[model samples]
Target: MSNAASAQTTKTPGPGTYRASCHCGALRIEADFDPSAGTTRCNCTICTKTGWWGTIVRPGAFRLVSGEEVLGGFSRTGAGYSHFCKTCGIRVYGHGDIPELGGEFYSINLNCLDGVDLTGVPVDYLDGLHDTWEQLAAAPHVDPVTAAKRLSQTS
Candidate 1:
């Protein structure tokens, strides 16, 4: 193949790598994803309490850079484990395999990202509390997708 074509094919993709760390900087992780694609906010009990703004990425795309010893995990939903920094008690990300979401995935907490600004990024709310993971939740307290569909049908 031509030299120019070879270089073009070998060049790495640009501008999406992000560095994230816990509050005390004990744990760190790196991932590559478009910030403009927005994040997901689930209305599940644990998510509501912990304030997780998640960016879903495949397992291969997420990397744990350091602090393996200090990392702790909690499995509230049984679907995945929410990993946190034991020192700072901050949830940095989660790992799980859900068939509905297309197998193994990592949900990175956007709040832990080092320098990325999420000013205008859209937040997709999910009614995980009601197990309606298929459609977006209208609001935190609003009805689940099925309930909303029923309401629409009656109306």
Candidate 2:
């Protein structure tokens, strides 16, 4: 490739990268995604209680930068490995693979991200509580891609 092309590619990040951490910063996560992809607000019991917002990401694009020892996980839905910081007990992110959405995915918590504006992104209200995937798919505000992504998560 030409030097100019190489330089240009190097200068531009593939999508945008967001940094997230537990409340105490004990655990940090980094991910590359299109923030414009929008975020999700589920009415499910766990999500309602945590008030956590997330954007679906692929496993290969998401990462944990530190605090592996302090990280812990819970599986309320039996589909997602809901991880948190053991030190401060803040939900960081979740991951899982389901039969519905082809394969695995990462649900990166937007609330934990730094230097990102989530309000501008669209919001999808998922009826995870009721497992109404079809209804969620039909919602005008819902992004079909993200809906399908989250569908990979077990209930």
Candidate 3:
């Protein structure tokens, strides 16, 4: 088995296999990830703007089941590419090469996964804006909806 397969050995109690898609259903993927292990939220310009909530897996653990022809990619830093659906513009996943992460890694957007409830999933916060990949962010990230509510209350 590949390292990606081994890494998916179910460290947490959650669905191991997930079906993911873009908003328009033009891009689809099958991913093997243990969500209970945690999802990631990065505070980088791209991630913040895209509202990315991702789970990382090696290439073997991620499969583009369909709609490859409709997938569009964008890369701001050139380290990796964020993929979205050409029709609906919903980012489904991303892939990049990060030496610290054992080379190539795939970032599956947890938001795109079908039938997965993330209500209580542990969120790993990355301070990507500061390039502190090794350190967690001082403040946990709030989703856009929550942030907006907070903004309104303080105003």
**Which pairs, if any, clash in model 3?**
none
TM-scores for every predicted model: 0.75, 0.74, 0.76
**Candidate 3: worst 10 consecutive residues by lDDT?**
2-11
Winner of 1 and 2 under lDDT: 1
lDDT of 1 by residue, 1-155 (tens): 43223221112223477777788887889887865666688888888898788888888789999889999998977989999999999999999999988999998997777754455456678788898865574322222564678789999
* For model 1, the run of ten residues with the poorest summed lDDT: 3-12
Q: Which sections of candidate 2 miss by over 4 Å? A: 1-14, 134-155
Tens-digit lDDT string for candidate 3 (1-155): 33234222222338578778787776889887777777788888888998798888998898998888998999988998999999999999999998977999999997777655455567878888888765574343344665677789999
Which parts of model 3 have CA positions greater than 4 angstroms off? Answer: 1-15, 134-155
- Candidate 1 residue-pair clash tally: 0
Ranking by lDDT: 3, 1, 2
Residue 34 CA error for candidate 2 (Å)? 0.7
**Residue 100 of model 2: what lDDT?**
79
Judging by TM-score against the true structure, name the best candidate: 3
Supply the global lDDT for candidate 3.
Answer: 0.77
**Regions of model 1 farther than 4 Å from truth:** 1-15, 134-155
Clashes of each: 0, 0, 0
